[model samples]
Target: MKTLLLTKEEVDGLICMHEVIGAVEEAYKAFNSDQVVQPDYMGIHLPSPRGEVDFKLGYNKANEVISMKASSGGFIDNPTAHGVPNGMGTILLFDARSCALTCVMDGSLITGLRTGAAGAVSVKALARKNARTVSSMGTGNQARMQIRAINEIMTIEEVRAWDSHPDTLARYKTDIESEFGIPVVTANSKREAVEQADILVTTTRGKGSLVEADWVKAGTHIVAIGTDQQGKQELDPEIFRNAKVVVDSMAQCAEKGETWHPLNKKIIAKDDIHGEIGEILVGKKPGRENDHEVTIFDSTGMAIQDNVAASRIYQNAIDKGVGTFFEFFRS
Candidate 1:
């Protein structure tokens, strides 16, 4: 039998931000509702080159497909030293019935969008209905993706941005204003941005706390996008202590995500977490009970997202007659 192969460009053309957001929400629902079986994820570290690749494997009973995603990051010299993106990935999709490899595709776009959508889903579930200001703490690629996904679900009157790199910050303002047609203002400092935000998103690759608990005001909903890896933190643990914290996965976050730091520091106990995003989406728990309540969503990313997204992309390719087919066993 032949296996389908899809390039990154093809995959980008096949799915939009809106569709990716919907698929990610479905994945979360399936995962929290006990329809997805996720195996333990594996990470391989490379010390000399300073890079890491993580493998997330799972079976989506809801979709009747098995999927594995491999994402590589931390190649700090890729852009200036090399011509390609620092992060690259590949996803393998297999048939649940026969366990046959069905398709192979570039996983970078899916990985980016799924994570971006995860933040959007959290905002949709927890942010106040009248929230109009967004403060983005970083001006990287993930920052752009998060803004795009969130714009699909909310009305943003203004976007306040802050970054350590002045050039990157300036470019972000130009690109976002041109693309979204919304006012993008550059903040002089992180506190200046965080203090004025109705919704805040942190997308920096930092190893220290970036946002202070006191900087965040009441009734704000924050999407903590950084701190997915061990030893990386963006917000003070005190922030977690004061807010209604929701994680993408309790087990994963407790060990590696933002939830882990707060636990290690004894600032907040495990019970302090209100619930997982899936739980909130499935109505097993409440979200944003009142406008005055402060909420934070710590997203470490998960496998169910990859499974559902890859499944959707594969099916769409088949329906649209896209991708290349080659015999995997060319005997």
Candidate 2:
């Protein structure tokens, strides 16, 4: 048997935002139609401070592919101590019928792109048609990808951003302006950013809520992407009280994502959730019933995202003859 091995650079070259959005959107539709099987994300936290590893696995029956990704994060000392990134991951792809290993590839870049694409999908389904002003919290790599993905679907006349690090915020402003030819405004506070946004994206890794419910406007569509862990939170619990809450995965979000906080506190019940993004994609449920409605898309990264994304990248690599192929097993 031969297996394909792809590096981060190879994967990045093979995948683009346009294809990623389409692939992720299809994965969501498949999930909504009961054509995918995904297990709950599993995590193991180290006793040492601020370190953990998690894995997500799923099978896309429609595509006849199975994927598993194991990733690690919150190792803050890695950069200073080891001169390496704080987060890293590996993705494995297998044939559904024979369960044979088909490909092994870098998953870190895939994770960021798929996650950004998920936010873009929500923006397409929930945001108002005329949304042009975007507010982004956190000027990190994820924030950059989020904005790029949004620009793929919306006009994005202006961007307002806030970050605790002034240097990072400044760089974000310069980079975005130079790349997109749009004005990037550095906000003094999170509220300022939220108030100026037609579409708001929160990608921070804060431990507590950085946004207030009162600051959010009625017609705003917010994509809360930072709070994927138990203690992480980016939006106030009150935001979910009256907002049309759409989660990536109800079962996973109820346990660890942004929905967990509100659900655990009884701020909102299971019935309060509008529906999964997949349901919205398949037209099983409505999205953005009115412009005056406040909508929130709580994203807990899903395994199907990795499955579809990896599958697409794998095929793209094969078609383009990008990645190296090696014979691993002898008959």
Candidate 3:
């Protein structure tokens, strides 16, 4: 048996934000149509570095995309102690018809790209169609990817960014502004960046809340990508509890995402979460029914998303011979 190996750089070179957004939208549609099967993810904590690894596996039968993903690494103690990244992962795609290994993709790039695309999907589904401004928290790879994905979907004229590190935020502002052709501003505070923005995206790994409920407006749409961990949170859960909250998966949200702690504390009930994003995408439920409704998209990340996006990029890479080939078994 032979397998195609895609390095991180190769996989990064293959993905585009627009394509990823399309992939996410398609996955959600298939999920809503009952064409995809997914299992709840499991978490494993690494002892030495004090981080957690997650597993998400799914198959979209109609779309012919199958994948299992394991993402880990968060050595928060030191910035550059290891030569590797703070997070690392890979995607293994299997052919639905043949059950054969189709591709092996670098997970880090896939995670960032797919997560950003999910944010883009939420923005498309919930944000005002004519929105032109976006405020983003955190100045990392996900932040950059979010800017790229959002820019692909909307005609964003300006992006405001905030980070605890002043120098990093400055560089991020310069780089993203130049790349996306949007004026980027560095804000003095999270509230300053969040308020008055048509759309806001939170991507930090911080454990404390960054955006408050009062700072949000009537028509604002928030996409919170940070609070995927049990103790980590970036947005006030009151905002989520009060708004028409949509999650990637209700189960995952109740277990690990922003809704986890609050749910455990009984601040939010099972009925509090409106529905899955797939339901809204498939038109089984309405999204943003009124202009005055505040919407929050809680993205904990999903495996079906990785499989769908990775498979698409992998097929393109195969046709272009973008990655190296190796044999896994010899008969």
Candidate 4:
């Protein structure tokens, strides 16, 4: 069997913001329609200075995609040392009917694109249609991808960002403004960045809240994407309480996502959450009940998203005649 090997650069070349947003939207619809089979993610904390290892696997029957990914949390210690990313991963794509391996693609870009697209999906489902201003926290690759995804779903006129590192924030402002043809401004503080924005996306991995409740406006839609694991936080707990919260997966959000932080602190009760995004997508629940209502989409990053996105990329690569072929299985 010929296995397709796609590098991160190739994967990046193959995907665009519009395509990723559409793919993730399809995945959300499939998930809401009860067509995907996803299992609880399993994580293992390696006893090492290297850090924890995480593995997640899932299949989407409607989209005919399966994905398995693993990441080692060590590369961030010295990002420039190996000319590679801190979070490295690989996604295995399979034939849904035959359950045979079809391709192996770089997972780092897949992770960023899918998660960014997920944020876009949330924006589409929850944000006001006329939302034109965006505020982003963090200046990492994920933050860049998130801006790309946001632009795909909305006609964002301006972008504001703030980071601990001034150099990174300055670079982000210049690069994003040049790329997106939108005004990008660097803020002095997280509060300054988030305040007066129509949409806010928190993509930092800070262990404490960088977003405050008061900074967010009544009609702002907030997407918290950084806290996909326990102990990670980005938004103030009071923001969650004031806003009607929608989660990708409530069960997982309770354990590892942004909601976990507030829940543990007794800031917001479980029932206070409106519903899952899937439920809202399926029409089982409502989204953005009123423009004045502060809406939040707590994204923890789900396996179904990975499966659907990787599967789409694999098929696209095949159709476009991209990726290197090797005989992983031969007669």
Predicted model with the maximum TM-score = 2
Q: What TM-score against the true fold does each predicted structure earn?
A: 0.97, 0.97, 0.93, 0.93
Candidate 1 lDDT over 88-138, as tens digits, reads 999999889878789999999998899899989999999999999999999
Model 2 scores a TM of 0.97
CA lDDT of every candidate? 0.91, 0.92, 0.85, 0.84
lDDT of 2 at 14: 97
Which of candidates 1 and 4 is the stronger one according to lDDT? Answer: 1
- Candidate 3 to native Cα RMSD, angstroms: 2.0
Candidate 4's residue-wise lDDT over 1-331, tens digit each? 7889998888888877788787777777777788878887877765544556678888888767677887655545546666755668888887778677888888877778888998988998899988988988998888999898888877898898889999989899888988988998888888898886898988887889898888888899998998878878898888988888999888889999999878998988999999888887778888887889899899987788788778777878989999999876766
Candidate 1 runs further than 4 Å off: 79-83
Global CA lDDT computed for model 2: 0.92
Question: For residues 40-159, what per-residue lDDT tens digits would candidate 3 score against the true structure?
Answer: 888887786668889989998876767999898675654567667677898898878877786787888888888999999998899987678899889988888888888888888889
lDDT per residue (tens digit) for residues 1-331 in model 2? 8999999999999989999999999989998898989988899888765588999999999999999999988888889988978899999999999888999999999999999999999999999998899999999999999998989988999999999999999999999999999899999988899998899999988799899999999899999999888998998899999999999999988998999988988999999899999998998999998899999999989999999999999999999999888877777
Worst 10 residues of 3 by lDDT: 75-84
